[model samples]
Target chain A: MNLEIILHAGLATGTVLLFASIGELLAERSGILNLGVEGMMLIGAMTGFSMALATGNPWLGLLLAMLAAGVLSLAHGVVTISFQADQVVSGLALTFLGTGLALVLGNGLTGQNAPLIPNYDIAGLAAIPFIGPVFFEDHSPLVYLGYIFTPLVWFYIEKTRPGMHLRAVGEKPVAADTMGVSVYRLRYFYVFVGGCLAGLAGATISLSVSPGWYSAQTTSGQGWIAIGLVIFAQWNPLRAALGAYLFGALRRAILDLQGPRMILGFVNPLYINPNLGFFLQMAPYLLTILALVIGSRAAMRKRIGAPAALGEPYIRGERGL
Target chain B: MAFPISIAIEKRTADVPRWMPAATSIGSVVAAFIVSGIVLWLIGSDPVRVYGFFVRATFGSWAAISDTMVKATPLILVGLACTVAFKMKLWNIGAEGQFYMGAFFASLVVLVPLVPAGTPAIVVIPFMAAMGMLGGAIWGFFPGFLKARFQVNEIITTLMLNYVAILWNNFWIFDRWSDAGFQMTPTFERNAWLPRLSDLAREYPIFSGITLHLGVVFGLLAAVVVWWVLERSRWGYEIRLIGDNPHAARYAGINIARNIILVMMFSGALAGLAGMSEVSGVVHRLQERISPGYGFTGIIVAWLAKLNPFGVVLVSILFGALIVAGREVQPSGIAQMIQGFVLFAVISSDVLLRYKVRLVRTRADQNAAGEAA
Candidate 1:
């Protein structure tokens, strides 16, 4: 019923997706398409919550979460990179491994309280109108981190010298190799970076955003949604942020739709018939498909596409992208 | 002083030995078990005792074997479903959704009384099977169409549709078809049930209490058919060609887009059959929690079987045992963890197929050669 509150919650929840998609964007930019985001996120959430609870330090928990997920990603790196396995299958295997590991380790941590990341409002910025409250008011430190993280990622991928090298590695590894860039090293590094960010996103959900562990439900399918957002954003961090926030708002609005019976003088079907909320629950997924269609069309029209060597294994003597 | 030892991995110029693939696969499974045991030990459980319990619980008696078989029935179909799509290099991760839709469609035969109430089992069973396949095929067609037309990624699309399909099923079971306010439809009449060995208890008292259903026969038939389709049929050749080399396949005048849609539908149909089998043979009702991740398990089964149809049946039985026994294991995720390790080991073991690994002495002469290389 309240637009402001919903948007505020949207921003907080959107931070989770923002971190995940941006992380995925980094890996894909380096010619590695890791579909293990969901698994990695789950691992992160569980690790963050449990670590915080055991240690009583949210910061240490956050760091350990990233480390755990990053270590897990190395498995993918070894398989797809060193052994030259299929990226899609390896990523899927990574998901299974991550989920299983998290589930095993996170057992009995449910309903236990943990030291969560504290929230604070920016003194002057919080006083501004709608933007002030939604963007700068009482929110987890991670939300502010996301705001700063997006543009920094954009800058690092676009304007920096290493960014050019990163793009070159993805688009034309052979060319990058000829220029003395270590394609394998960069891919591994980026994949690890992606893993760490996905872990951070998971921690955001368990330690900052929602502030508890719900096992698999903690990240739910947000990690997958983040992957979709990467496509919709065309691998751009800024656009990913936009899509993430919009999706967050949409998710929040859907939950709120069942709250009130009357909506602008019209009876809300979702409120009247609770079963109809199932359809409302489906909006985000349906929109992802719609987004994919739009994204695909745009890519075709603009002749913009995925990284040329996105899913290929880079062998030193192989004749390929 | 030079290093005493070094590892070398050289690409194999010659074809791998005939037994290498099989050896690697078996090795991977054993390795996975060892790794899972380590994890179990790390978690403070006795790995040997736990594994012992698994074997005993799954194969302890005829009844346990029958239960495992029931679980394997759906797995065989779903594994075949994954095999067909993965062979074409199309990732149809939505087998879970397709399975649900299949169950929904199968249930429609009895719930809507599509035939009259007293229809014979002969007519009604086949109708239900056909409807189940139809529902699954329909569920699969959208992602296939999207991928073929727009070059959209099938993995994400298929996965997204899974959530939609489950929710769609929920709407019906929760509100429209609730069996006296329970989250399931009313049980189907006996005519809709698949014939089981237990049904012949009057003729053979030894078969009493057996829950093994005709669905197992369906699974066996599906495996043979899938094997034939992949190995003997001309379309199978086309599919393999596309899978191995898409550009070569296109140049050979193969219609890639049409095959994509067809193969996806075929794959979906198999998974749909799995959903139907579970509903008609076991649950006997359309319910929300019918599957305990059979579709997801099927992916691992297919991979473990190396995409062979007969191999799928064997793997499904093993995994079926895992599922059956896993219910009793503590911490609840040991089986899933073992599956993950198996998959990881399997893929990693492919290194043996492509490269020859050796430990070379690196005192003086070898060290010089290594640097020169």
Candidate 2:
């Protein structure tokens, strides 16, 4: 019941969501929205769990997870890029199909155990002793990707040429296309990359944190949280990471604060219900709504920030998304 | 594949050209079966044999027919739910949640003396069913209100509310609703369960082993009522106009936001009725895991039916076959994989069904109007 352990678990949860969110932000910024992250993440988690256990190799598990997700993401690219189906519904359907496929394919691996990736320290960083153990020492290697992606994503979107072009599509796909940028091609690349990151997030759950277990609800609503975080961060990766960690801490705190001996009366009602932990589980959703309400204009200022054709598919020779 | 609920979809709804429908139907079936076949083969199963099992499991016997009906009942009802609200462009994605809520309401009626204890089973069932509808209606209205008042996206709100409803219903059945016995499925009084159709017992032969409750009749009747509402009513015209061209409809004097709220409420009520029927017919009580993601799957059914109520009945049964047959697939894993593939194929075909993918043949199709038409 230590608060720190609870906080660490929450951080792990946030990291899973953060990996996916950062990738999605990259894709959405470039004016291509991918809603299949949930499905991809589920596949990743299942694949990661099975592979890690199957080969007793955590590295392979993470690799397979990413590959699985990356491959599944191709479907989204095909539908949106080639056929011009509405991205919103297509994404929704893809997620369902992906998750269902993962569950069905993963039947033999249920109740299995997974090997945890060994922890490592930054050179000379382990010398910090107490702080390192809590913040760095004992976590899986993939957990660090959460931190790396935040800043890496930030630079890629802000400093890279293709990143700039990607943003241009969101601002004006027609303009980007006129500039000789192939919208479909750019969208496919970003979506595939984003999907791999989502896969990594899922593997982080199975191989790094919960290790080896997979359920249809295993990924739960973290993918949705990533969607919310994109808005909460105002689509900034660095800010998204912060928001994810803070939310993760909140989730952990709820459980840490709960014990059979803990008194309920006189506590805040939101934290007082026996099912407070369960309801608090909906923190990401409530946060999304709250962020939207607080930054209503910020959300609508899509012309300056969001993808020009975020939920609209790109059909060549068509008028618009 | 195809989006079932676009404004452009309805205008082009003339019965597809004779050759196109037949070709597309064959294409889609072949495409679905092939994809499922390939996936099954990877897992070391024969696609041909698995598909045969799927077909037989779904249609080969009377038990299969009734079982498929049982599975399709709520889906049909919920499909009708999505059709009604979707007409106004109100996406009520929370039907699964609403269905669970309906079961909760019906359970309360069974547990609480909302009516006289000696009430006839017939009277009690309908009354409870109505109460269940109200429960879902209320849940539906909140998002409708938010969308109407603040221009909030109902898709996100409706989807989020689903988990809340599921948790709410789950907590009740797990904690307050059940007795001390470790039963996840609560037992409702005999007075609460709806009676089966008379003809079903007498008319059905030995093969039709599954229960044919009154809910099937309700599901069919719901389709008729919904078809009449959407196709014949003046309000239906408004909904249609809103769906096809909301901006023009509004310019010409349509209460856009108000229509959203009304349509959503009606949709939620119908979905709730679907849930109510399930309780009154089969499950007979509120329990954990009340839905098997039916609300979400029902969206596809609504899409496949082209949001037409009568079409919903047909499509729901088709999807229901997969769900039932999926359970009976000779070797479970491969059967499910094929079943799952069929779903994606069905949805994918709908995409091609709705839109024509032409090469960049001319500049004329560059305008919104040209592409839309």
Candidate 3:
């Protein structure tokens, strides 16, 4: 239960969440709710793991994973945007598609280990007390990429002109249209970017964090957690990083608490009842619900600044209040 | 911008016929099959042969048909649950979790050895059913209450609750109820078992060894009851009104909050019944993998049925056939793939019913036509 080790694991776990939630944050900011993040992540993980295993190149695997997920998400955009389908149902269907496709394609790769993403050791930084060993000493380059990407995404979404347009499109597509902005184009672009990041998140899991290709259940419920993180972060990339780290810490803490302990050979267990482990594992999801309950209040939402037209689909020349 | 073969889909303002949804639904299923066929061809499978087997395995014989019904029993109940919730514009994505909760509670009644061994089947059955409903209802109440009280989004809440339910079930099965290191509880007593067709097969030669259970009958009865409620009951009218426009319903002085809880509880109760039937009628024990996404599949059924109670029954049976047939095929993903495609096609095809697509000629095509003319 060393604090440094816990923080290190927390950073690693948080990177996966960072990629997914940041991508999901982008999608939600574009007013498209992609609930298939879980499915897409599973597909991405399978593709990434298999490709990496075949080619012996994790980077190419990550790229291919992104490509696969991007294509899948484009189908979602087509259904919801072009066909005007219900976003929720279409997203669920996309999940089913992703799950089935991944399972079919990944029939041969279960339990097979792939080459892991290499971690870099900063020789000079490793000597600097607690912070260095925990954050910079030993972690995958993907973790570093997350550290770099989070702030960049934050800047892009907050400080840029196109970012303003993206927000406007999400908040009021009609008004954005009157302003000569292509609402559909912006939304599509952001959604695609979101999907790419989700794919990257999956690659992070299979290539770096877990370091193997498993079944469709590999992603477990991480994608859903990422979605909740986006809401918990109030759609802010920086806050999302913080939320992701918090969740990562909680997850790590659960494992630590559940581990066997022996003090002076007395063997006092943390959780004697095995069933309590499942209940403890529920922290992340239960916390998400708690956050949502508080976040959905009108006053909190106004303060947090949720998009006004978050889940509403936009159509050209539609008259409405 | 001039475009060639551009399809313009415009929303229709006129009233559509009552049969339009059903017609479009069939069309979507056909379209899904065609799309899946292309996928099968790409993957080097003979689509026709595969589909033939699918048909044969599901409805080729009386036994196959019986198996299909067995699968449809849970589906029908879950579909009814989805129908009720969706009618109020409430997304109860936790039906899978609620189903698990129901199964757990129902299992607890028998596994805990609460009732005596001499208890009659009639008494034991209804008690477990009630416990299952209560379990699912309590689970459903959280999201409904959160949504009504704080305007929390039920979609996320319900989805999150599913994980909680699954974990909760895992906790019990993996520990307290473990059947000597196995990830399941001991088998329920005979009194707790739902009577199956095979039970009577011993005396009647015609009904021999069929897996068909009373659950199918319960499903049919539920469909009828749901249809009556939705078509005739005041509560159903209120739910529909809320679904159409909650603001309007509230303006008309309806208690939207209370109705939300009530409807969600009712929906969860049916899903609970599905879970109860599954444990009592099929598995006869509390174990891991009780449902293979029946709750999620129910959403597809509800949508395919256009939220009609009768349609729920038929669609459930159709999906049941798919699940049953899927087992006979290589790479079992075929059934799931088709289900996914069906959902996609059905959702996309909704546009056809609501809008008219106009194919416009591009500038090049127009110029070529002008030149020809």
Q: Give the Cα lDDT of each candidate.
A: 0.91, 0.73, 0.85
Most accurate candidate by lDDT: 1
Give residue B8's error in model 3 in angstroms: 2.4
- lDDT by residue for model 1 (B1-373), tens: 3567786667789999988877888899899999999998998989999999999989998888998999999999999999999988889998999999999999999988799988999999999999999999999999999999998889999999999999999999999999999999988999999999999999999888889999999999999999999999999999999999999999999999999999999999999999999999999999987888888899989988889999899999999999998888878777888889999999999887887777877655443213212
lDDT string for model 1 (A1-321, tens) is 799989999999999999999999999999999999999999999999999999999999999999999999989998988788999888889888998889899999889999999999989999999989988999999999989999999999999999999999999998998999988889899999999999999999999989887877888889889999999899889999999999998999999999998999999887778999999999999999999999999999999978888998888766865
Ranking by DockQ: 1, 3, 2
Per-model TM-score versus the true fold: 0.98, 0.88, 0.95
Question: In model 1, which runs have C-alpha deviations exceeding 4 angstroms?
Answer: B362-373
lDDT of 3 by residue, B1-373 (tens): 5334555555677988788899999999999989888988887889999899889999999899999999999999999999999998899998998999999888888978768778999999989989989888988999999888887778888889988998889888888888998988888889999998888877897788688998888799899988888889998899999999989999999999999899888888889888999999999998898998899999999999999999999999999999998877767577777888899889988887877666666454343112211
Give the CA lDDT, 0 to 100, for residue A171 in model 2: 68
Task: List candidate 2 stretches off by more than 4 Å.
Answer: A121-134, A263-288, A295-305, A318-321, B1-26, B198-210, B329-343, B350-373
List clashing residue pairs in candidate 1: none
The runs of at least 3 residues in candidate 3 whose Cα sits more than 4 Å from the true structure, single-residue gaps closed, are: A262-273, A297-303, B1-4, B362-373
Docking class of 3: medium
Model 2 iRMSD vs. native: 5.0
The lowest-lDDT stretch of 10 consecutive residues in candidate 1 chain B is B364-373
Which DockQ-derived CAPRI band holds candidate 2? acceptable
Candidate 3 accuracy as TM-score: 0.95
The sequence of per-residue lDDT tens digits that candidate 3 reaches over residues A1-321 is: 567777888889889988999988998898898888987887789889999999999899999998888788887888877666788899889888888777767777877878778899777877888988988978988888888898988898889999899888888888898999987788788878878888888888999987776766678788888987787677888989998888887888788776666534756355466567888878888998998776566436477656777778787766633
- Number of clashing residue pairs, candidate 2: 7
